[model samples]
Target chain A: MARLSDVIEKFIKSLLEESEGELELQRNELADYFECAPSQINYVLATRFSVSHGYYIESRRGGGGYIRIVCLDVDKNNFLHYLVSEGIGSRITEHDALHIVQRLLEQNYIAPKSAGLIKSAITDKAIGIPSTLKDTIRANILKSMITAVMAWQGK
Target chain B: MARLSDVIEKFIKSLLEESEGELELQRNELADYFECAPSQINYVLATRFSVSHGYYIESRRGGGGYIRIVCLDVDKNNFLHYLVSEGIGSRITEHDALHIVQRLLEQNYIAPKSAGLIKSAITDKAIGIPSTLKDTIRANILKSMITAVMAWQGK
Candidate 1:
């Protein structure tokens, strides 16, 4: 049985996919359709549709309140630089890292084999340090590798 | 002035470089030349010239005993596969991982950019786990990435 959260996430993703990575949803309508509380919608947005997951969500609270979701666009020229300074920062979790990698793959910034290499390198299993330090190291490694790619690509 | 151990390491490396990665040395004689204890020579070999560092050492004991050091050769065809099964195994330290990357770079099996990416992926900073689990994860990641490279290269 699929969890409500998972189902909601999938539904929203499908909507985004269909709408070309941008969409607006009425929280009340979605809640009613799923027979769930609006809070469930909020939960889904906060967790599965967060910036870390390559999404930017804006919620308006009013009579006409709506949730606006936008997928982060990868600017071909500056994305690697952006990722180093902003996307990865100094710390990153495995989930967030994987999401970023997924986005890169989707954008065709890296080949499938390269994507696999990145995933293998950044996976939680590979970064087998104390929980406190894992994210920091993952960030460093990811940044360095991205820089390497940029150099290779002559960017 | 460089430390005795460093000097000895460099001297041996130069010898190997000159000899096409194979050399034989009598420990006592080298120690006398360096005006140091034989144990010091042993220290340099143990620390700087281990198999993990991409050099293999064989010691023959007795009057005719000699220390033979051979650099690990990367067989262009099956090296990546060999690394997954034999070289990387279940666990790997940063030092060992770096050495493998270096060997690949030297052998021209990977481009500089790909080398940079591989190094970044396997580095300790990237694998931010506990010391105990770090090596195992590093091994997994290195193996996976190598497999990725192999695929990309159509090997």
Candidate 2:
């Protein structure tokens, strides 16, 4: 049997396909259709539709309120600029670095195995330096890395 | 990833730093801090703190005897050879490769910007392949990159 989460994901994806990649769903109705709790619907939306996964969600509450989800287009040029300029400061946490790698994977800007390599390369443990200096060093490293990746892409 | 042995090794090393490159501790005290069996400490000492990683451990087991740890200076040539042979295998994950790079950076083998460029170029994503194939390619790439780095240093 398909897992409840999997089924829910597939159903929503099917809906998205029909709706041209944007959707506004009735929260309660989705729960009723899946025969699951409203929180389960919320869970699905939270995990599967995050910005890092190339989604934009805006939810409204009360009567006539809806859950809005948009399949965001991957803007590599804009993203590369942000990553180099403001996205990475002097030091980036491993979690945030991995998040960006995940985002790149979701957008097809980078491959999955490459994502794993990038994650490993940026970690505190990998850097093997004092905690205070890691982030600043990480920032410089990531900026140069992103620029290099862009140049490799002939951008 | 944070194995008990690895955690124990890090804790001991942290204490060594504060103690000016050497430390003495009760096995039971460390076991108590990590809430693991006392034997776990011995396991970590026997494995991770071996001479190859540039650590030395001595213990006199008894009521008053303490385990002592010391950080050893690395022999760059020997360390580099070990990294190429054992630290990286036919498949080098980004973690292992990056660890080597970080060590090189710390040892002044590569400059900070050069390290970043090296990381970007050697990543599996830059190579673009299936996960199963990536490690093999990464190993080849890392070895070549390291050789290039060494050559650059000599030049």
Candidate 3:
């Protein structure tokens, strides 16, 4: 079964596709239509429609406040640069990492095989250390790797 | 069509691939998934993934215990080295892998450029995959990258 968030994400994306990657709607109305609370819409937006996911959003609260979503036409190379330099912090959650890779894969920035290799190298078990030390290493490793590839491709 | 044992082996291997070189499972549940007797899972585990195949297995029979599988570190250059050859798999932790790269650098086998390349290429953040799939891809990249470097050196 599809998660409610997933369904909402798909529904929102469908709307964006028709509207040239931009959509404006009332959050309460969207929640009512989906038979969910307005908070649900907020949750979906926060997690799924983040900047890392190539989305930009602005929501005005109170009556007549419309939530506007702008799907950025960001290129993979530029996105990759942001990911290495600013997006990734000292320690990253598995979920965030997966999101970035998925975007890269969808945009054809990286080969599927290369994507897989990236995942294997960053597991908690693979790092085999205390939590405090893991994140620092992950950041260093990820940054260097992304930069190396960019250089290789002359990007 | 594959034999029952072959099917079992493949299924387990598939799980291992997603897991990046290790897996822990309930034998009974696995047997149920395969629609075979519990003995079938045991037999496959014993025969197909023996110590000779570069695997380590440990199992406990009581409740809440699990069958633990660790892909040993087997050095590609020195097949007997536990940290390299047997240690890397479909998934690798950041720490263990960094250790290997550090060793390579100390040994002067890989230049700083190549080591940096290796780290970036393997971060889960860089790969951006679901946890299940990250490790396998990581292993593949590391192995291919290492082999490619070795080949370059030889020529």
lDDT of 1 by residue, B35-131 (tens): 9999998899889876446565656676467888876554543777678658678888899899999998999878776787898777777655446
lDDT by residue for model 3 over B87-152, one digit each (tens)?
A: 675577756666777778788866666676677766666655445545655565566555434323
DockQ of each: 0.23, 0.06, 0.14
lDDT string, candidate 3, A12-80, tens digits? 999998999999999888899999988999999998888867799998878788999998887667777
The number of the candidate with the highest lDDT is: 1
Better of 1 and 2 by TM-score: 1
Candidate 1's C-alpha runs over 4 A off are: A129-133, A152-155, B1-81, B89-116, B119-140, B147-155
Flag the better candidate by DockQ, 1 or 2: 1
- Candidate 2's residue-wise lDDT over A1-155, tens digit each? 23587689889889988998899999899999889999998888787778766788998999999999899886798888888888776667766776787777767776554454455556555444444645655555556567766765642
lDDT to native, each model: 0.78, 0.68, 0.68
Could you say which candidate leads in DockQ? 1
The collision pairs in model 1 are A128-B129, A128-B130, A129-B128, A129-B129, A129-B130, A130-B129, A130-B130
Predictions in order: chain A TM-score: 0.74, 0.77, 0.79
Residue A118 in model 1: shift from native, Å?
1.2
Worst 10 residues of 3 chain A by lDDT: A120-129
Candidate 2: TM-score of chain A is: 0.77
Q: Any residue pairs clashing in model 2, and if so which?
A: A90-A135, A90-A136, A91-A135, A114-B125
